[model samples]
Target: MPEFPHDDTTTNPFAAEPQDRLDANPRRAIVTGADSGIGRATAVALAAAGVDVALTWHSDETGAQETADEVRTHGARAVVARLDVTDIPACGDVVDGLIDELGGLDVFVNNAGAGLQTPFLDVALDEWNRVLDTDLTGPFVCLQRAARAMVAAGRGGRLIAVTSVHEHQPMVGASAYDAAKHGLGGLMKNLALELGHHGISAVSVAPGEIATPMTGQTDTDPRTEDRPGIPLGRPGDAREVAALIAFLASPEAAYISGASVVIDGGMLQMGPQAGAAVDTHDWRTL
Candidate 1:
């Protein structure tokens, strides 16, 4: 038998102290795409949790200001900024600026994403790249910046990505969207693994058919709507999704990293059953 080398310096991984420990209560957060929809809801939710928020928007400055107002109602500091994630590396700079304005960052929520409904065969190179840049590349840059800030501060943090149900299941006419979400979900898992040593948690919140502007259901009451395919009989509300995000951002979720939490109304569970029960081929088109 070969003699094993003595390794007196080896220590139990579980016994090692994290490079940075999470704050007992997170104090500041950033929510991108807070102009409206899920991002807006998440911003307000964090504020209600007594966390100061920095809100970023792409097109709707008015909407972002509205979200900031709501955040202020919770007695939390709210700062607004314009951020177009598709702008590439510049977006990462915007994140850094916001982190600075907030004094520090305890959480960063990547909620800005776009999808194209064009068929895969008809998708132009520009369109595909646009979607990918917005949904994946840009987010990766910003999240990386946020992670660096957290590491430098030596105070653990949370990184939340608002992915889609498409992250787990592909959709018709959503090739680029599906690919980006899948990549984002994978990225979050990797971040969780790499950042855990620093006490930072990374998670993905996947929503399905939410009543948001992205779904053309802004201001719509999901409870009043009916969805025959979903077991819950309706689409989800942004607030519901936000609530889940808020929980994940909390210290209570320190051990729940490297996970994609789905907030669909039992939609994923109906996959095979719905496929078998469909009475028409209309689903083939967007």
Candidate 2:
């Protein structure tokens, strides 16, 4: 075998000194779409971990207040704000404002997202724009602002996006949703690479069939529902996903960057098996 040349001058970009990892204990965090579901759960979970939380809601101020109340029950300070991710650059200002209110930032979770069930041929320009802006472009702006705050604070940080299993696999009528998630996944990966030198880590949490308002299953107990296709035989609860997100924001997960952690109860593994088992053409429609 021929000898492989190594560039000795290039050091490990991910290496950081103990002093550079100041935010290892993550004092503060911001969670978007926190009025309900995964966002609310994440807020509460982070609070339980002793991290103060700033939560954002779009149209449900009441629900946001409820989340804040729960966070406060954990003895953690909670701030509430409105965040419409589809609003583009204006949405970024909301993130900055939240950071200012929280005093600083250590963990930023881009959990606000929208989904569409329209087929590819029926997806209109307006709908496409809305989904794309909400899921991808808006997250870009918000994450950028959060990253800047982290860099300015000179503390290590965590940037996490709540993607979907569709980030890796496609569904019947989720053309726009899938595309946006794919883009967001790629964006997190790139952020991980670029921010590593700053002692910041970026990751994506890709969930499967979760029992949340977005799934038309509000106030549901996922354990009671049956999902034969999934190895776990049930839909996931928002709290379960929240636990994972909270762990990722902790110092223990410092090395887990640029990864799409799937908490789907093994739903993606059944793809080929499900495809072969289906004896009808029903899979082609929503």
Candidate 3:
């Protein structure tokens, strides 16, 4: 088994102590960016919990199909679609497409995002736009579509988003990412307030460093040795984050809304991790 950051037996302070809150096990959800990384894990976890999943992919149809197959192996129907979150206008159509295919949408997880790590000084306008459009506006588009569907169905629904630890804290060289996530956090909160009367809830799950392809960094990398800063003394696993999303999407988490659950192993609370030491003897100016 591949060891993950949070694979240890030690307890996590951020997660709900008793996961019994989600015992009802609601089925049927749409997970955006479900082709790989944390999104794929969430889709699989939901399937394991008996949730039929509509898994969306952007540039990887094959990857999306693979996730769908996994979902089916878990005994839950899996619907796959190629969805580009940045295509703002088509977002509504995507939701309707999922609902039409899956029969109905009870839970919506906005997990599609693009990470931009350009320095603030060198960050271009287009980069900022791209990050904001995907991380913030994209979710809003899905939220609007999902909210309408939930209201029409006359049943309360769950609207969840996967933000980043930067949603609340700041990180150097991540200006675009930080701003977008921060905006997304605020967006979810506002949606929660507006939709609460209609029995709909919106929330965000912010993850820290996870052993995902996006980071391009591994546990063994000496640069990651400062994991001690995180109370858990390591990064988190994709599955661990998925578990939380599954719980929130279920009927049991109905009372939780407008909340941003930080799953960074207490890293955010402890402040930024120390910058890795680097050797700089030979240098060239570009």
Candidate 4:
């Protein structure tokens, strides 16, 4: 395989200006797609930060169990559930059942997603509907159910959507996926507005290429991969993304909401000029 180049730069993840704000107060959280990658990492992070987690998987109940085990290592009770977010009617039952089991819901991480990479012309109605329903509609329902529970709990909560960089930009062969992400981003913004008064914060975390099972990369060190397209010199790590979610879920982020944060290593900034910037053959052409 051809090697990808990574930007040879390093930066600190924390600031020295203000005292660090780390909270591990043992809250309850539900992380969808917790079977692997970003979902699994987020679950681990939440658990480590003193949050009991309900791990929901699309088709990886085994992986979800593994995550639950890791979560339990952090002394947080972890539960595993088979959750196909695309099954719209089943969403309510799943959410309600899980919340009931957990006693109460405090943070909901909508991390489940399905990607459809067909071009616009080749995308059939079923493909469009499948992607939209799974990526957009399913989360919409889950958000509502979680929000309702949060409102009733009267504790104010964190609602996070694990969107994509495509949520803010576009790709050649990802029309359907892009559409779904765009819709998800918009829905989060609206949810942020609607849920604010209830003390719930809705935010979208847009990740660029990350070393995750979703990207056909698991257990691979992203540091070894060369990704010139990313200013950071490599694709992101799932743990890195999870750290963001953990911070968002913490009490320190209580004042933040309705924000769409891009964690793409500056790829979004080079969108229009990437072709010219790469100095390679016309590989960008479809």
Q: What residue pairs are clashing in model 3? A: none
- Model 2 weakest lDDT span, ten residues long: 6-15
Flag clash pairs in model 4.
4-226, 6-233, 7-233
lDDT of 2 by residue, 3-112 (tens): 96653434755556645483469999999999999999999999999999999999999999999999999999999999998887999999999999999999999999
Ranking by TM-score: 2, 1, 4, 3
Q: Give the TM-score (vs. native) of candidate 1.
A: 0.94
lDDT of 1 by residue, 1-286 (tens): 9997654335645322432255468999999999999999999999999999999999999999999999999999999999999998999999999999999999999999999999989999999999999999999999999999999987889999999999999999999999999999999999998998777899999999999999999799999998999999999999999999999988778788999999999999999999999999999998
Residue 127 Cα positional deviation in candidate 1, in Å, after optimal superposition: 0.3
Report how far off residue 184 is in candidate 1 (Å).
0.3
What are the clashing pairs of model 1?
Answer: none
Write down the lDDT that model 3 would get. 0.81
Better of 2 and 4 by lDDT: 2
Two-way TM-score contest, 2 vs 3, winner: 2
Query: In terms of lDDT, which candidate is stronger, 2 or 3?
Result: 2
Instruction: Kindly list the per-residue Cα lDDT of model 3 for residues 215-275, writing each as its tens digit.
Output: 7653333235467667878878888899999888876686899999999888876753333
Best-matching candidate per lDDT: 2
- Model 2 misplacement above 4 A: 1-14, 20-23
For each candidate, the alpha-carbon lDDT, in order, equals 0.93, 0.94, 0.81, 0.86
